[model samples]
Target: MEARLPYDDYPVVFLPPYESPPAWVPPHERLYHPDYNNELTQFLPRTVVLKKPPGAQLGFNIRGGKASQLGIFISKVIPDSDAHRAGLQEGDQVLSVNDVDFQDIEHSKAVEILKTAREITMRVRYFPYNYQRQKERTVH
Candidate 1:
């Protein structure tokens, strides 16, 4: 008697081997692709300018820390909001807002500065996944 394997009667289809995508492709576009490795080493820090009309929410949260610590980090970005549309992401360390350095500023003062501005320009650095992982390992 011959042994029967499951789905043996079905026709076989083979696919080509996967190749890594070019580094220039935006991170959002690479998501879900089989060859995407989530490496953003080549990504450079950029400034994002967002102009919010009166009564428009900034759509993000900020956490204030000591003056000696690093700049305030973007804790959260609400989806489909002004911040999200402006490409704001969690873990972005903010360097400045509208040409003002808030690195050592008080949290409330920073919040006030952002609150009064209709046009906000933020310089942020996005820490890559590998870098963040390494930071965590060293912290512990």
Candidate 2:
């Protein structure tokens, strides 16, 4: 009687272990699928300057303290509106308007600042939805 083994006639080859690129490699230089490179998390907060003609709506809502506690926040952005076209997003914390600090400001006062300006320069911090939800869930 002879002992039998599976695939006794097949040739086998071994390959060296694969190594990933070093962390120091720049993202653009790394070998990655083109479709995988669009990372939304890498986006940084940016200031946007919008020039609205008189009577033109900014197309966003400003809320104070209710959801953001001390910070004035962009509550809503109307689709296809000037604010939307200008890159304003919901949940962004308004840092300043023109040159004035908006921290802890009243909602009406913030609106006043916006309404009085023909050209608005807004500095905002982008608040990701997940981060905001996590913040709201935390008890403090």
Give the root-mean-square deviation of each candidate in angstroms. 15.0, 15.6
Q: For residues 1-140, what per-residue lDDT tens digits would candidate 2 score against the true structure?
A: 99666796767887756778534646675567444455665346579898889988888886664344556777789998879988888778788999898876666788888998999999887766533653454332
Best by TM-score: 1
Backbone N/Cα/C clashes per model: 0, 0
Per-residue lDDT of model 1, residues 10-92, tens digit only: 78998756878565756777777666766674356778898879887889987643442555667779999889988888877
Per-model TM values vs. the true structure = 0.60, 0.59
* lDDT at 33, model 1: 69
* Clashing pairs for predicted structure model 1, backbone only: none
List lDDT for all candidates, in order. Answer: 0.73, 0.74
